[model samples]
Target: VLVGRDIGTVVIPEAPIKFYIDAAPEERARRRYHELKKQGKHVPYEQVLADILRRDRIDSERDLSPLRAAEDAVRIDNTGQSAAETLAQALAILRAKFG
Candidate 1:
């Protein structure tokens, strides 16, 4: 399953393949802000950004199962890439791997 940092490390270590999609904290926060706004939650952008940053720190420093990429997982950074580009890259990788 595509999931959080611990999925490959703890939950499904035996899966033959894995991928991890990443983005900058600011980008992540922006996405979250829009998501909540779409849901009609009237929250400020600054608050969402602060919470996103705080969660990043906590997840990074947690003792058990700290957030980290798997040793062999494909890492995809979507910082500046568009959604279409990201999907194409991901699909290309999968096709190459399984074809």
Candidate 2:
């Protein structure tokens, strides 16, 4: 199974490969809002954005197992990329490395 965030640095540290995906705060919040809306979750955008920022800070600044991109991880910034586009990029990388 694919893990996220602190996967490489903490959980499954011995995994053969790892990736770090991130987006701008505003963009992430917007995406999250839309996703939740589609699910009928009526949470406010401001609240979601605030929570996202808060979680980011806490995860990044935590003393133990802080959320960090491992030195060997392939980083992907999906700020403007669609889900299909992002998946294609990842698949391309995987095929190039494994095939």
* Top candidate by TM-score: 2
Candidate 1 ranges beyond 4 A from true positions: 82-84
What lDDT score belongs to each candidate, Candidate 1 first?
0.88, 0.90
> What lDDT tens digits, residue by residue, belong to model 2 across residues 24-84?
9999999999999999999999999999999999999999888899888889999999989
Worst 10 residues of 1 by lDDT: 1-10
* lDDT, candidate 1, 27-54, per-residue tens: 9888889999999997899999999889
> Which parts of model 2 have CA positions greater than 4 angstroms off?
none
Q: What is the lDDT of residue 21 in candidate 1?
A: 86
Measured by lDDT, the strongest candidate is 2
Q: Which 10 residues in a row give candidate 2 its minimum summed lDDT?
A: 1-10
